[model samples]
Target: MKKFCFAVLSAVMLFGFAHTSFAEDMSPKDIMIKNFFVNRVKDSKSESAMTLINESGQKRERKSTGVSKLQKNGIDNMRLIKFISPADVKGTSNLMIEHSDGDDDIWIYLPALKKVRRLVSSNKGDSFVGSDFSYADVIGYKVQDFEHKITGSENVDGVDCYVIESVPANNKVRQDNGLSKRKSWMRKDNFVTVKGENYDLSGELYKVFKASDIQFVDKENNKWQPMTIEMTNVQVNHKTIVHFSNYKVNTGIDEGYFSQRNLERE
Candidate 1:
């Protein structure tokens, strides 16, 4: 039984590799599908510094640790992030579990509250830990939930990229992500997104996102990670920048480590 299971797993992994290997003359949806799993490493852990800047140029910084692992199916991902700095926000943690149906389950543990609160779907658009990134952004939008089209092509920092525009397939998806439309600039070389424009619920430009300092964490699997990410809310003149360090992948992190018990623990 074990041997058969192992063989099946190997074939699945090979299929995934083959899917991305032959990428020439692909469609817009094909590109989006490849982008979705571009960095789906088996497991990873990293330390991060998050900075939030307000309209008046005031800044609030916090440190955090994050860990993520792929589920048995090798598609959905489970992630947990815990704050580790600045007296006020310390000991706060968030847990996110991706669902196959495009609806993710999220929970947050606040130190002061001493209880875990489940984040409902309605709150998916709310800011994450007061940062410009929303809960849905943290969890990511499933490819099937949106209709993707190749809008155009452009060069970002000398690298050729494809500008893909995505719109919600239905009202539920739009409300869930609080986004009417999104445009992403993905590199032709690696399919990594370097820039994005997010339109608000009213179909007005709202946030601009930029990613830099890409690192190949899993070279064997062609996995890339962005060391720095910035999201700016143009409407409010506020922004958030997150820098990740000490990033490690495929460390054999135990699945149990992503449980609520660990998220709530100080």
Candidate 2:
């Protein structure tokens, strides 16, 4: 008898074989990779409302539209988000482009300035449009940016999940993300992240994140999307909740839509 070895060359193939008997034997890196691409579609668009609550219980609501599309390589992604309501923040937009081997590019357009400003790596941990979520959270952390290990298993909303802990791979990564470590509860069945805890530079709990109202957006591709996402700052007692609606996937969005010119449009 001869033994043979197989390699997972793509995210789709990796997901396809993840449900087999080898699931239990998969490495933490592979699991993270699967989670990163779980909801990866050719293109998607949606409208969402973000509610920000302060420690004093005051609330501010913002409406926005978002569009994302994968590049030709199918690994990198380009995203653009434009705020549509609230006179103070209206016409503000953000554009992000993912890089497979280096730092992601982020740009912000302010209606008042009428110019696009690029965000440096140090700004990755900064609040996204004054929300509890950061730029890194909006674009997502790259799988290779951290070292991951399965700490344990738990149930999230009655769904079994793998408790994976991730730490920055280097000091640069740590400073860029402003997180010393993070723990995520990834669904066992579909690899969607149901919950997460982000640790600060001092290794203390900083924020709690949760995702709910899961929807099977791309049934043909076995993809799942979360309709609601919440991030709470524990130390400050502030929170941000975003509810997404009217999600459209595989819409063949044009690549030019993510351009800086479009991002600055009113």
Candidate 3:
């Protein structure tokens, strides 16, 4: 009675643990679609996202409110932002993924254009802060963009997920050129990512990243994390709930705090 194996990709490429990669015979719906893209790039010290931006069919009459901080995801970090929505663009300031490949080099710390405006995204399918989520569908990809396969299983909100579909192999990211196809549902007893949907570059259905309110930020261990988040934005219809309040996990943040002048003075 001995069968022990644990290298899980060198403990997730050296101490990250939640790495995720399935199909050794997969089926709890392919380990919940390989732990839903391995917890969608797991590794967090601090994250608080709240983005609400409506810019058409003017009846919510134009809205805005965004606040973020990811501090260390490498590539010169510092993602401390603030834009308290509306009221004439209330004190703008954003700095995300400051510059690794400079794919989404956003920086606009304008105390009324007091400087810092370099959001040159040549069209990674654009539109990130103004909602309808783009900017390469919010910066992500490591372990080579796509080719995971495990397409089967559903029922989402009531558990029983794992319907993975990620398809991007580079026709410049399959012609949509940035984050074209992605659909995940994951959750077979842990792993997270309860549902996701993103399709832009004229394929419609912009963003629908959902998740519920499960706690256990570290309650001795039953390990669950998702206080809330609900980015709608289906083609400028707008919807942002995100309420993950005061979270702190693993706290080790420091890759020079993802610099870019500390993301414009974090």
Candidate 4:
């Protein structure tokens, strides 16, 4: 029984290696989106810094406490709470995640209203809180949602980066669901997604995310670590940006942190 179990596990791992990544053979989009959604995070209490700008020339910033739970079945459920201004989002929680199966769900809890609101919209490209970035871009995506093809590699800011294009699949289940298209640039050496371009409903370039300051936080090895990440909406005139800082990767946050009860609380 043990040998049989090992055989099955080995085969499964091999299959994932084939379809998911053998980085050397990985398509740029495959490498990028995979890491964005399924990369294991540091297990610990982490925090993030967010900056928001709007078309009206107004800017607001907030800091949040983050807890990440990576499930065995290729799912990452993350909860973020705004801690800076209590009244602003006090007791509010945002559920950001990606699942191996099913459409990704983004939910927000409003403290004032004491309501949990699902952020789904008829338009998946809608801006998040008026920021230049759509809510879809911030959350990672399922690997099966799109067709991945390697477009080649090029030097991006002096780093050898893999470039891949992503297009929605034609399967009837996902046809015309509002995410038109996207492109990604993944660094070759570290396998980290450095930048991404989001297309509008009409397949027009609209936003980009740039990642940087990648340093090994726990340093057990290079595979798991935290890095500062920043995203800007370029076609929206570069008027908006979101920044991440003080990132502690692989701190091994408890899985219990992701329970539905906690999702409803502070």
Q: Write the per-residue lDDT of candidate 4 for residues 52-131, one digit (tens) a residue.
A: 76656677766667666656553445555445443565577777655444456667777678777876632345665555
Could you tell me the lDDT of residue 30 within candidate 1?
73
TM-score for all models, in order of appearance: 0.92, 0.92, 0.28, 0.76
Q: Candidate 2, which segments miss by more than 4 Å at Cα?
A: 1-22
Clashing pairs in 1: none
lDDT to native, each model: 0.87, 0.87, 0.53, 0.60
TM-score of 4: 0.76
- What tens digits encode model 1's per-residue C-alpha lDDT throughout 143-261? 66789999889999999999999999999888878899999999999988899999999999999999999999999888998999999999999999999999999999999998989
Error of 3 at 119 (Å): 1.7
Which residue pairs of candidate 4 clash? Answer: 41-250, 42-249, 42-250, 42-251, 42-252, 43-250, 43-251, 43-252, 43-253, 44-251
CA-only RMSD, every prediction: 4.2, 4.8, 17.4, 5.0
TM-score of 1: 0.92
| Model 3 accuracy (lDDT, Cα) | 0.53
* Error in Å for residue 141 of model 3: 12
Two-way lDDT contest, 1 vs 4, winner: 1
